[model samples]
Target chain A: MEILGYITLTIFVGAMVLMLFRKLNFPVQTVLVVVSLICLVLGAVFRFFSEGWVGVILLPNEMIGGIILHPITALLAGLFLAGALTASGGFDVLKVLINKLQKTPIGLAGTLVILIQLPVIASLPCGRIIAAALLPLLFAFGFEGGMGLLTRSQLIVLIGAFARNAFGSCGPSPIGGVGQIGEGFLGAFFPTASEGMLRAPQAFSLMLGTALTALFLKLITMKLYPEGVSLRDLPEGSVIEKKKAEAKGSFKGYLSLVIFVAALLISIFQPFGKMPVQTILVAGGILMLFMCRVSIRDLMSGIILLPVTAMASGFMAAGALASTGGFEALGNILKGFSSVPFLGVAGMLAIFVQIQTILPLACSRILTAALVPVLYFFGPAKFDLITWPQLAIVMAAYMINATTSCGPSPLGGGGMMAEGTMRADTGYIKGAFTFSSMAIMAPLAAIYMKFLTLSSFSASGVQLGRDVWLIIEFTLVIFVANAIIIKLSSKVLSEDVDKNWLSQLPAFVIPGAMGGAILAFCLYEMAFLRIIQGAIGGIIASLLIALMVPKRLTPAETGE
Target chain B: MDCGTTEWLTFLFLMAFYLSVEIYQVLRRKEGEIISFAGPDIPLGDLLGTRANVRMKDGEVVDAEMSGCTLCLGRFEVGDRVYVCKNRDKYVVSLPLFMKGRRKRSDFCKSSCRREQASIQGL
Candidate 1:
């Protein structure tokens, strides 16, 4: 049975790789469904004498239902809201705001800063929508020299940097799908910590990791594209035209945007009763549809626009993997390395990250849900060798990596959107983005976890030294190693450089200092209210910016 | 055998079969040629609306001006072939076309569509 588990696991992994590389052209839903049915039939056949075919069939059905209900349902609601907003031209408001930024006196670097910061600050649950809206503006910035003094390659780097930052930060949003999934898994596994207690710290840790990774990637982009490349560098007619129009959004569109913002704030702060994020989203979407005069039929059609079945099947596969003892078998194998602490933990995280990256079907949420339990069950609990904080570091690493690692694969989700919108080569983007993400994220995760642990210990009046020192040392070593790796890799993979190596000094120092300050605040004084306040403040600031833009440039006129 | 062991063995067999099917599909494909099935005539309304009733047949699709799949609602590019289901009055933009792949024919857009078709056929 154990050997059989291993074989099944190998085949599953192989199938995922084939799909990712486009060697398998079948729909992902088809592949997953087939795999799942086969597993069910085989299980039934094997257990016929004991449990009978009826039991086997019913079990798998129940498992599928369980997998689909909570996270997938929530995700569907989010997707529906995103669709409605897009249909109602809510995103056009942001596009107009971004366009107006081009006219601002902020230099190329400052414009680049706003571009990078916009998505991170907006932190909308639907990443693809955000990417779809912004990618063209980024391109326009590159081609029309919106990055004022910065060269073309710097623009690409900045885009990549923002992509990494925006996607990684999803795990922290209190009202986002990824955040709900991460929190669900965390609460399930660590019963002692209430969801509320874990929410703020998890959000802070994930956000800090993202900020640090963004800073590192920015520096690397500077080195890699010392001479910048621009849209003109590409063959003529290759650049995709901006999908949204240049006119200011309509009054209704602006109102819809405001409602969406208000909904997110109300969901997060819960000034009234505790409303589910999905409920808020659904209400906002309906209100937007009515206000924007979109037909109900169109809204329903928009809801089904996303590949919900494909994602649901992916979750089903995760459930199957768990039910079949694949996770337990892998966990048992990993247990041997736990005695060595760093090697075991790091190895497991690496495997999880690799699996999440290659397996288009294994979404981060389901993957985390399946694997974290296995870790808790098989970890070094007997000796009490690993502290909860250390385990948190591991969980944080997995959570951060699982969310961001999918950015490079052109399979589905953000990767497909990024490739389609940016017109960049998926293969090249995958390699550079994944490598840069791991280099920055892995160490930053350790540092953030260490800070979290120390803060907790200090609050409890407990002295901590050995574990903290070890983590700090590990972080420094990992940081240096990744820096060396990136520097060398850039040399071999460097693209065309057009501009003089203008100082990325201001760009680097300012963002770095700001990110450091934010991380410091999060570590010491962060609270749920503070996070909500920040979100509300960011929304108001964005709305104020939108109001300043001329109405003529909105997407309604431009046929977005 | 224990229930757990029985479950594991069943999963393994299923995975093996799935792997074999995938390998066979890969080996059987004709290299360097895009495979597209000729679909039946689907009205423009059916293609644009949420519900479609077009089916795939040997004949060329006529009077079915290309558009997004009724099921998935994704935009279709020029030269992209789609799956037309006649009995169910549904049309799905082929997965290959949707993902911009070079190979494979227009079938159900995804597994759910295939399953829906099967149920409609009382399979």
Candidate 2:
């Protein structure tokens, strides 16, 4: 018979990663396939035998299958989107905008920060882009400014850390979805408990607040120690080399963007309602090849990278872990929070969690599911029916949203990006973002708990218990409001020389469209309701976005 | 009488060799002075123990790039002056000279340039 234990063990060895960094050695996509195949085989055995080893290993088949499909589909879709963006020079357009912002020391610093952070908004969780772009700038700066070797290293590391945190915190991003689940779970358990007991909005707020707080602290640190620095200016001889490429007018650029976006949308969502994400992505990739006149060789070169594959694997592994009780094990560990006073718990936990040591790809899924149900089961008293589970679910979802990393967790992509871009050691900045965010979560949780506690049975706030719709709506509103703040800050920063570089970057439609497509596919497959409609809606949204974005100015126009 | 004659001969030969050495240096200095040969190179002296500027003929500037410097690549830029050390292989340039925390600019120039210009000038 199919042995469930065998299935779970296969995933455990392949999918569920330990805190050690060794697993980053393999590409995530390959690992996912290997582990997934093992699970499938065991699942088959369980189906046939219906006893013994196979049954013990196999989890709920539908959930596991759904999880397996999520990242695989998303990756294929993202590959097309990224490829199209690259082919059309859309990525270059964004880069030029950032490069132009480096008119002064402050502007340069700001640009560095923004570049490192931008990917977080789209939920691409690595900093290789940041590292590649910023390292050269720092090198150029060193050449011109005459900075000492020590100072240059310091700048790269510090800027990288800050940028990582900024990206992870961008908007009411879906990357935070897992946390949303956790909040729903936790709020159910602690309604009417004090604002201190709640974890979601409070912890999330704290994460944002603490990141800003660290920035201030960092500024103070730089001020106290004065150092000599120098940088090299580009030789007059080099200017001739840069002017060879003639830019097509802004119209051509915009048209290219439209094409890329259209392609992305069609691939992600079934505008016609029946296509798979992989099929769409492959088609989009092919279309980009034809439009750009790029060879198949060039397309492959752009598509392959360690980070992309790793992300796919990480997602698959996390899903497998969730299916096989890995999440439950983690949740059991966190159950210690129940014994602590709700008010002090979040703040205290934030300081202690050694985030850098734990690879975020492994941690996000386990933590989310583990916390969700527990929070929901223990929730509060309602007016008429006194249904505990429903109350618990609402309360838990809200609180958990704040405290957990889910997608935006500093330990994940954002953290890695910051470390690589800034040229700082990976864990250095992650520590600051994580600890400080944790501090914010503690107070926020308390406030949430307090509101729940004093809320009357007949009050509008109290009705939130049964109103799943309200919970989702309020959470979304809060998330969007925060995202707006982040975007506005980014815009203002573009003009300032000393701000983070990533903030001032113009948006790239192709990649953005690609992200939209993959996200849509993931949601559709998971929701399993009107998947085609979701896909179609996604495509339309991408096209609209492509059409609306303003054409980016070239580097020459910016006097770079 | 024999001892005195031998000592005098030895002294005369030593003086002759020293004179030829001085003459050779004078000719070299004269040749180097021609603009075509690259006009008199100036040694700015070492600004720090390991840093200096040497103004080569035609005003070519070179900075030291050091090994194992905190900067991943050795390059230092201090304002318009870039101090690159080819021998050190690390680039660290500091501006305005004063912030360099060195005792004197001339000291750095001397140690870094290593009296190359002085030798060229026949100093």
Candidate 3:
């Protein structure tokens, strides 16, 4: 039975990889669906051999219902919202805003930082929509005075910015795709824990880690491509010359943006009992469609562009794995390592990180779903050392690491879009970005977990000991190892390194303010009203900044 | 049951096998040489042969003639160096554009071409 489970699991993973790489030369959705069907058949056959025909019949539906439906519904709703936003020309407003920020090097740097931070602020269906929208603008920076090649520094900055946003978006927001998936799985495994207990600390930790990573990458970009010599300072060329004048500001676009923001805020605050995020998003999307006068045909077309079918199939595959006792087999295997002295936990974490890095897209949600159950089954009572909350912290860290690491995979969602946009060597970017992110994020996640655990204990008046200290020590060792690995890898990967100091002031100010607002909400137990007031203050400040910029005249009005 | 010696051996063997395969893949990859061409000197169509499907701006499929590269339609002269994909089967890019300090060959001729393909495919 164990062997059969392992075989089924292997088949699923193998098929996913082969399909993802297009080694089979078939449509990815078709491949995923076909593989899922095969797994179901194998699972049924195994069940028949082990139990009976009744077992075979009942298990598949139960698995699908229990594991797949909730996440799939949430994902589909998020995709629908993204579709509606695109159709309503909300993305065009974003493009216009990005273009407006390109007047100076400082402005361009600030815009890049803003683009990195947007996903956390406004959670979308994965980072694909944002990547598809913003990456072209980054690509536009590659051309200047007929010199079209992107400098190494420019490429690194663009890739890093996109990667940070793509990875960080999901773990920070409960409404985000990975967030929904993680929270759903965590809720199922640890039903007693409050949603805030599980999600809030994790979200805060991930946000802080991501913010620091983004700032570091931004600084590196600035140093390498100094303000004076940066791509923005290059001579004006055909790319800029061909830039279309911004369309007249439409009330529909503004109204759509407002509606979307309002819906997100309401969902977050939930003044009236726990309303489903999907319900709010769907309502907001419909309102936007009505305001923008968008047709159903256009909306459908936009939705079809998203990877909804692929993600659904991924969920099904994960469900099938869970049903077949494959997760149990996996846990049994890892249980051996856990028994080893000192290195046991570190070994397990290393393996998880490696797996996450290697098979990012599929593992992003699937691994989290599979592992949480294993943790619940084997934790505290079985291990007798680590508490449930400690296990939860580890799960949170894994979720952040797994989902975010997918952003740099050349064959995965955000990375594929970025490769298409940049038309550059993605192999180097994949390696460099993944390693660099891991080096920072792994330790940062550990530290955040420590902070969360310690703070909670302090508040509750409890004593903690050697186990927590051991984990921290292990994390520091891993961090040092990662730094060494990065240093060695850099020798071979070879990026241009230079030094300059010109602070991207606007870049720092906005993310800092946003972070401060969220932290205040978290620490002081501030009301949603306070958060709303801060948001309104931000909007006014933005309006004032907009007022200062010289507006471009319409082509007809200018007699072009 | 506790994880026995057999299970441990199987796990170690599997890990070693996976590691070896990954190492082999990295080592086995062929690195393409960057060569120069100028003024219609490089026969990109001939070199690419049936691998490339050239298309025009209006979504028309064109012949893979010695006119220029399908993506940019920029005529290459002798002494103009260009990068080509080491593993040509892996990428849609036939003749890669020139890039400084580029180690791995790009999968597209230009950024616009890649973007156009993505937009059309709705990727």
**Please, what is the whole-model Cα lDDT of each candidate in the order they appear?**
0.44, 0.33, 0.45
lDDT of 2 at A59: 53
The candidate 1 chain B region of ten consecutive residues with least summed lDDT is: B39-48
TM-score of chain B of each: 0.35, 0.29, 0.29
Which model, 1 or 3, shows the larger TM-score?
1
Q: Which candidate number maximizes lDDT?
A: 3
Docking verdict class for candidate 2: incorrect
Off by over 4 Å in 2: A1-63, A66-68, A101-117, A120-127, A130-158, A161-287, A304-424, A427-430, A440-560, B1-123
Instruction: Name model 3 segments beyond 4 Å from true.
Output: A16-23, A27-29, A98-109, A139-152, A188-248, A304-306, A340-342, A366-386, A410-424, A453-560, B1-123
Top candidate by DockQ: 1
Q: Which 10-residue window in model 3 chain A sums to the lowest lDDT?
A: A547-556
Per-residue CA lDDT of model 1 for B2-39, tens digit only, reads: 54554445345433433443343333322122122222
lDDT tens string, model 1, A278-372? 56666676678788886544343223323344445656666665556555566666555443443333333334433444342323443444444
lDDT-wise, the better of 1 and 3 is 3
Chain A TM-score, prediction 2: 0.47
* Least well predicted 10-residue stretch by lDDT in candidate 1 chain A: A548-557
Tell me the DockQ of each model, to 2 decimals.
0.03, 0.01, 0.03
